[model samples]
Target: MDRRRVIIDTDTAGDDTQALVLAALSDRIEVEGLTIVAGNVEFDHEVENAKYTLGLAGKADEVPVHEGIRSPLQKEYETAEYVHGEGGLGGELFPDTGIESADAHAVDYIVETARENPGEVTLVCIGPLTNVAMACKREPDLDELLDEVWVMGGNVNCLGNVTPAAEYNFWVDPDAANVVLRELSTTIVDWGVTVRDSTFGPDTLGRIEDAAEDSEFAAFYDTITQQVRAFNREEMGEDATTQPDSLVVACLIEPDLIEESGEYHVDVDEREGMTRGYTLVDETGVLDEPANARVVESIDAEGFRRLFLDAVIHGDPERSLA
Candidate 1:
């Protein structure tokens, strides 16, 4: 089987780390690079988190990381520090990988990569859409050039996370979300599906803890998830670890994980209001517009948990739990 060439545009926070590790260790994916954008945390911290996470997957020296935009396309910068913590890693301290980001800007790298390998590269965007929108603007045919674009954002005809009507990623940069939704052949792994399928409680955490006894990757994962798990339990009234980014990556790696999906005309609300960044998913075709996105409505919950655990426990050869 030919490995899918992938470029992950991420904010590199807690769950973003899980996504990166999964991608880097996957046999079916050849990660082309990681492009860092501003989101969950500070720009520099996010870049560092990417390098560190790649190191955990034994790809620190191999996969190049490129720094992207520092803020949203047309909004003031916002962060979910309350959810992700100040350092974006649950305040856990790990040894630095001493890896540095590639000198190229993320927008330039994105455009150049797509231009160099048309219809082969898949972009898994797990953050704000600023970098992707700019790349589209820079290369007008980028959407056509890419093999696929999978995004982990939007509420998609459901309630949101950051606000009553918007998910955090889309809320941070609605303009960019609007642009990419309109331009790209995108697939959304939205917030509702994540809350329904990807949230894991103590049983799953116990499994990770068991794996952590032998696997450093699992240990690192357990350590970093401490804060988010607490936040989810205390604040969200959910006793589970939410890893939406990892769920989206799993869907891309194993398509069968998606039990239900549909093509929809999706758009983001850029206007300032309670509905700002709200994802209007045209499920009933009321607007009579062409569908722009394949929205993932549901996924196999047990399959996702297994896939994530398999990666965390035995993905890296040197750090395998067994």
Candidate 2:
């Protein structure tokens, strides 16, 4: 099979950075480009974070990073600074990429690239869906332009990180989320519950640490993930942490790591207040709507741990230092 052409859209913070590195390291997929959106941090920090991540992995020379939407379509943007830290990368500051973010706007780039390679591009979106929705609105036939989309968002059980009924990515931009959930034909959805349950505990982290021993990438990954682990310890009392976005990339690289919930019609609430952004997953055909997605309901946590550690540890950072 041809190397899967992929464009990763992200709000590069703690785990998103890890996801980016994994994609950069994977030989089976070619990263066509990277598009940034505002989510875990502000738009500017997320873009720079992407560049900094690329620099860390030595993939800066390969991927073209593009700036994306700063705010949601109908709401003011909010960030998870407490979880991701003040500077987005767990407060461990790194030098600027020194490479300028690409001149092409994210929405335009998404449109043009997907159009150029029909049924060959996969957008791995790990953040708010603003850029995608905007691009689709611009081109009415955007669905025909791309092959597949894997978006990491929503919660089927209504247990969410940002709010009781919403995940952060969708909560930030329900209007965009709604559009993507309703209109995008080939979307592969990853829910918060599935990712949250399939987490990396102390054992997995120990493996990653041992494998990444003495490498700068390992230290950075360890430090950046500390905040999340600490928070998880305090909240859940078990240091079971997750890089939810990375799971999307892992599923792409090795599909067996994920199990889907078949085709289900999904809807996102766009109204204001508590319930807004909730992903109404109609599992039993209760909504009586056509299916637009194959919802990922479970992941092989152990399988993912092994695959993620293998991919991330073998990157340039680990080998170059040898």
Best by TM-score: 1
Candidate 1 global lDDT: 0.89
TM-score, cand. 2 vs. native: 0.93
Give the clashing pairs for model 2. Answer: none
What is the number of backbone collisions in each predicted candidate, taken in the order shown? 0, 0
Name the weakest run of 10 consecutive residues (lDDT summed) in model 2: 313-322
Model 1: per-residue lDDT, tens digit, 1-322?
6888999999989899999988888877899999999899888888888988888788998899999999887788578777777778887655677887799999999999999999999999999999999999999999889999999999976788889899999999999998898789999999999989998888999899899989988998888988888888897786678889999888877888899999989988899888889999999999999999999998999888888888888774223221
Question: What overall lDDT, based on C-alpha atoms, would model 2 receive against the true structure?
Answer: 0.80
Which ranges of candidate 1 are over 4 A from the true structure?
A: 316-322
lDDT of 2 at 27: 64
Q: Give stretches of model 2 more than 4 Å off.
A: 316-322
Q: Write the per-residue lDDT of candidate 2 for residues 112-230, one digit (tens) a residue.
A: 99888888898898999999899889888888778888898888765888778888888999999888876687455455644654577888788667866666667677878878887
Report the C-alpha displacement of residue 109, candidate 1, in angstroms.
0.3
